[model samples]
Target: MSDSPLFQPFDHPKLKTRNRIVMAPMTRKFSPGGVPGANVADYYRRRGEGGVGLILSEGVGIRRNGSRPDKAVPNFFGDDALAGWQAVVDAVKPTGACFAPQFWHVGARPDDTTRNLPDAPIDSPSGMPWPGKTVAEPMTEAAIADTIAAYAEAAANAKALGCNAVEIHGAHGYLIDQFLWDATNQRDDGWNGPTLKERARFAAEVVKAMRAATGPDFAILMRISQDKSPDGSIRLANTPAELEQLVTTLADAGVDMLHCSGARFSRREFEGSDLSFAGWVKKLSGLATIAVGTVGLDVPAKSKLFDSFGPGELDEVERRLDAGEFDLVAVGRALLADPDWANKVRDGRIDELIGFDAKYMTKLH
Candidate 1:
C-alpha cells in the first residue's frame, strides 16, 4: 500500500476520502430537457459502485438560461430536475463514497435560443463580449441579489437531496469567472474595477451563501482557473504575490477546498515559486486543494487539443500526492475513458487500462 500513491486515503477534517483518486466533473450530454433520468443517475452510481473515493457530478445549471447548447447536462431548477438529481443521490450514496454536484450558471455564455426562453433573463457582471459577440446586459442589483439567493437555494437543495458536498463552478471563464477577470468584467461598480478584492466580491458572496446553506460540516469546494476558454487565454493573477492575495481572499470567503483548474497540474504558476498553482493555493490558504488537468489519460479533455497520452508522473503528480501537496486529484478524461481506472490503479491493473477516445465525450459507457 505504501508503494502506490494512488491507493492512499486522503483524510480530511470534514470530507473523508477513501482513496486519492477522484472522478472530476465531466459533462455528458445525456440528460435531455435539462432533466437527468435513471441513465444519468446510473452513470455516476457506476463509478461510485466501481470504487471512486469521491464523485463530482458534471456541471448542473443554477438558472433557467444558464444551460448549455445541448439538451442534456441537467439543471437544478424545477421539480422534475430536483427529483432526477435526488434519484442520483439515492443511487450513489450507498456506495460509501462522497458525492457532489458542480453547481453552475453560464452567465453571458448562453446561446440566442436559450436567451430567448419565455421567462429566462440574460444577465452577466457587465456588458461585455462572451464566446459569441452577444454582449451581455449589465445585471441589476436586484438581479445580482437574486442570483446569489439562487445559489444558496441550490446549495440547500443539494443538501436536502442527500449530496455530501457542493462545488461552485467558478472556473473556466464561466459566470463567476467573468467577474474575476478584468478583461471580461469592465464594470465601474463597487463589485468590479479598481481594486482586486473589489472584483472578488461577487464570488465571495456566492461562497458565503453556499457556506451558509450547506453548513460547516458539509464540504464546499471552489473550482478556479487561471485560463479562459474559447480563446486559450489566461486571466488569473499573473504574479505569485497577487496569486497569494487572491487565494487568501477566497479562503476568507468560506471555501473549504480549492480545486485549481489548469491545462497541466504539475507546471509552476509563477517564475520564482517551485510550487504549481495548486501547491501555492494550498500553501497560502491552508485549505484542502485538488489539482486537475490531464491526469492518467491519453489526452487532455478538450474539443480541439491534439491527441497525446497522459501517463506516468509528469513533473510532480505522484510526488505531490505523496508529499500531501493537494488533498485530491481530479481525473476528467481518464475516468471518462475508464470509470474503473481508480480500482485498476489500486489493484495494479494498469495494463488493462484503455486510451481515451474523444467519441466518449458524448456517450457515457
Candidate 2:
C-alpha cells in the first residue's frame, strides 16, 4: 500500500486533495421535490469520513424547465434546494474532503416519459434525442443563451455554498454532449459544424460563462467521454488528433480538469498506443484528468451496464496511476456499497472490503 500511487496527494492551482481518490457522480434520485434532505447529507459525510480526497455530488439539475426527467433528481437552484445543499457541504467539510456539485441538464431525453412537469419544454440543440430521431423543436438562440446563464448561476451558487470546486456534467449523452455530437446536433448555425472541434462551441461557451461567474481562483471540472450513453460504439473522436482539438478547445475556455469516463479505464483508447481515454486527454490537453468506469469490479467483457460483479484487484489501476496515465481514480459502485472503501484500501484491508451489489443502488447507505 505504501508504494501505491493512489494514496499520493494531488495538488493543482485551484484544487488540492490529500489523496487521488474521487467519488464519481452517480444519480441516486433520493431528493424529493428537487430538495435534498438530511439522509443525503449523512450519506456524503460518511464518504468524507471514509477518507475520499474529493467527493463530487450526484448530478444536480440546473435551473431549467426540462433540466431533469424525474421529480426526485436534486436541483442546484431555488431556496429550499440551495439550503439543502448547504447542509450537505457543511456535513462533508469537517471530514477533510473537498466537495463539488455536478451541475447537469438531461436535455431532450429519448426515453424520459416521467417528467416532473409534463408540459415543460425539452431543450435540445436540434430536436433529435438520438440519431435519426426527432421529437421536439430545435432550441432558439435566446433559449440557448438563457441555458448558458443558468449554468453560470449554478457555478456561482456552488461557490457560495462553500464547495471547493464544481463539475459540469458534459458527458453521457446529456445536454452538453448533445451539442457536441454531430448526430444529435444537426443545426446549420454556428453551434454545429463538420468536425468534433467545431461542435464544441456550445461547451466552450458554457465553460467561459462558469469561469466568469466563479472568478479566476475557483476550480472547474468537466466530465467528457468518447462513448455516449444508450450507445457505447459512438466515438466522438476516432483519432488522437481529433481528441486533441476537442480538449484543447475546452482547456482554452478555462477547464481546470477533465474527468474522462470510459467503459474500462485500462482499455487502450487508440491503435498503436497504450494510453487510455484519460491518458490521451491529459497528454493532449496537458490538464488534470480523472479516469472512471468499472473500477473495483470484476466486470465480464460484454456485460451490460450496472450488472452485479465481484470485487476486482486494483493492481492494474495502481500501475496506471503510478505511470502518470491519469491524475485521479473515481470509484462509483464500490464506494456506494461501502463508504469506508477508501480507508479500507489505504490500510491494506482488501479482504475486508465489501463487494458491489446491485441492491446498493436502491437506497443510500
TM-score of each: 0.93, 0.97
TM-score of 1: 0.93
Candidate 1 clashing pairs? none
Relative to the true structure, candidate 2 reaches a TM of 0.97
lDDT of 1: 0.78
lDDT of each: 0.78, 0.91
Write one digit per residue (lDDT tens) for candidate 2, span 1-365: 75579999999889999899999998899999999999999999999999999999999999989897789999999999999999999999999999999998988888758667778788899878799888789999989999999999999999999999999999989899999988899999999999878899999999999999999999999999999877888898999999998999999999999999987777799999999999999999999999987787754322346444333558888989989999999988889888999999989998888777677888899
Which candidate wins on lDDT?
Answer: 2
Segments in model 1 whose C-alpha atoms lie over 4 Å from true places: 1-3, 67-69, 110-119, 131-134, 298-315
* Alpha-carbon runs more than 4 Å astray in model 2: 298-304, 307-311
Worst 10 residues of 1 by lDDT: 306-315
lDDT of 1 by residue, 198-315 (tens): 7788999988988888788888888988887755566578776677767778889988899998877787788876687789889878998999878875444445553443554533
